[model samples]
Target chain A: MAMQERALRTRKSLIHAAAAVFAEEGYVPSSLGTISKRAGVSNGALHFHFENKRALAQAVEDEAADAVRGLVRRADRTGASALQALVDTTCGLVDSLLDDIVVRAGFQLSAERALGPEARLLRTWHEWVEQALLGAEAEGQLAPGVSPDDTAAAIVAVTVGLEVLAGVDPQWLAERRIAGFWELLLPGIATEQVLASALPEAHEGRRSEAEEA
Target chain B: MAMQERALRTRKSLIHAAAAVFAEEGYVPSSLGTISKRAGVSNGALHFHFENKRALAQAVEDEAADAVRGLVRRADRTGASALQALVDTTCGLVDSLLDDIVVRAGFQLSAERALGPEARLLRTWHEWVEQALLGAEAEGQLAPGVSPDDTAAAIVAVTVGLEVLAGVDPQWLAERRIAGFWELLLPGIATEQVLASALPEAHEGRRSEAEEA
Candidate 1:
């Protein structure tokens, strides 16, 4: 492999290892030496990719942020309505939290008081959710009595709540759970016509996969 | 004060100090020395009250649990419908989370992996919510087609999510935020007649208090 490609692979591995450690042991207790060992890289190699633990954590969060953005983009690209995209994005994000250590750790790290001001992952998710609700309102997809701002707050809470709970039990990350949230919420927030067509699929396939485990 | 009364006061102070430290620094990093110093008691006194850091954390959690039970009891005594009691209890819990250091710390500790299974505060909250929804369903207070299980899951997610978010911003714990949640949710899950009567007070009184702050 080309040196540049190998360097990139090493960098990626280091980030993943760091994320696993941070998610399990938290930011304060996680050490660079342990991360290097988990990554199967020399201490010097780890340092070459990142200057310090803080920089490494920031990189993990940035990567996770990119994943969130990608989920939103993919959801939007499906040509779904704004409300549908919001539902799809939430499901996608929860799947990422369950399957991707980096994303899980990103959220876990963001909640850590030790990380202080640099933790912006939760805020980023909240902003996107707010924007989606506003778009739905502008398109007249929302129920007449629903306030976009208030709906946004509720959606963010449910999504973040699921994320927090999933940290303790992965069942909370199931697609069906997200679908269930929309099933109850859509009737209350979507216009009659939109509610008819915008209901999220119950995600039977993915839920079965969860049950198998 | 009598000898027993003075000892009880010392124990209470020690628990409070420990909670404050644990909430700020997290479980694994919190020190018995710091808790003792913060309590304004000698290390010997702290040890006499609690055997170790783990025991001190357990005491905090137990105290917080008692407070949660108290909130439910107060709500139950209002002679409201089961659903109404659930809403009132939620509002009361959020208020307690905002004002009580011990409750806040108990929740924080419950989420920390270092504390392990002994941290049952979140589970305790989740179980109560599930029971309340089940009771609502039995009373025919729930809207047709709404599953008590699913609705309970959503409510738990929103409550836990708000509590998690409130750790970063106390505004997330505002009565208005919890009120907003119920406002959006009550319409979707309550029966027509139940919905008419069960709408959580937009909590004008509490919202104004939050606004003043």
Candidate 2:
């Protein structure tokens, strides 16, 4: 049991180190030597857990995928309008990306052709956004003229775009800019009555509480 | 003049070759050997035109900047509503990216951290959007409730987002999807009377006429 615990801890540390390197330098230029060195683990220990850079990247992507899945699950328990849940979830995601190298590297790796499209993580995120909008439209939470499909496309585009921009200028993912996106888009997607509840700022407390938790 | 023309042609070919490789392999991994081979030029010729990869990349950026500057100049000549010109320019840009590798490489290179913040092509484009929207607001062409600043932010976000998505999926930049974005957004910005003109398809003929010109 003690042996297993030590191995698991080593694996987690290696992943953290790999995510940081991949996020900054990308896949082709990243090396096992640097990753192992960064993790403060021996090269032999690194090989014991992962054989190659591809496998290491895959491990990082898998963790980020789990993080995204967790966001969707959390949204399921929100007990609010689907639209509100989506707003909260997207805002939550941007905030998470601000601090989480694993999640950010997962996205960066997915964009890389070297990974060979094995992850499909971005598409998975889009599908989740689509489902959220569909649920809102079914619940009659959407404004009369809004098309759920169109709204989903734009939302996915904006969020992904913000992620890309954040790669260079983190200011793109600021609380005000993200909240302002919802402010500009909410009036077109949600009825006036629900607009206040659906505002991104309305969910600010949720983020803070999560941070505290 | 004949020898000078040959040098200019060789220079243009090298830039094109470099852009294609950069777009495919990114900064660190791309090589002058591949670029020269792709351009069907000799190593000596490549070296004559560019001292190194960084120099070659700077040339690519210079061409892209010219393209962007041309877009701004064309906008000045549009002789139409500022909002409409903004829409047309963005859609035009998407088309340009599809056909022009230098422009495509320009954006990809700008995203690269090695390039630092020197390119700022995206910032220039965003400023242009802000100006267009500001002009529309000044002319009372903006819809009653729409704030120009917020609207410009959303538009910039969406366009940048679409560009990112297009990197992985070219289908994201299709005419129908681009048109759909305008269709969904026009109602919120342009008054009912001007709605028809703001739709992306409304400018399809305009694009083709220019293509023919």
Judged by DockQ, which candidate is best?
1
| Shift of residue A199 alpha carbon in model 1, Å | 4.9
Model 1, A1-213: lDDT tens per residue? Answer: 699999999999999999999988888878999999999999999989999999999999889999999999998899987888898888888899999999988887786644575459988988999999989998889866677777888888888888778767888888778888877777667776774452445433323333464
Candidate 2 per-residue C-alpha lDDT over A155-202 given as tens digits, one digit per residue, 9 for 90 to 100:
877777777778778987776666767755664566556654534464
Clash number for each model: 0, 0
For candidate 2 chain B, which ten residues in a row score worst on lDDT? B202-211
User: Candidate 1: where is the Cα deviation over 4 Å?
Assistant: A202-213, B202-213
Worst 10 residues of 2 chain A by lDDT: A202-211
The lDDT of each candidate is 0.82, 0.77
**Local accuracy of candidate 2 as per-residue lDDT tens digits, B58-103:** 8888798789778867977978678778877877777777778998
Best by lDDT: 1
Q: Write the per-residue lDDT of candidate 1 for residues B16-122, one digit (tens) a residue.
A: 99989987887887899999999999999999989999899999988988999999899888887778889899888888888999988887777663458444888
Docking class of 1: acceptable
iRMSD value for model 1: 8.2
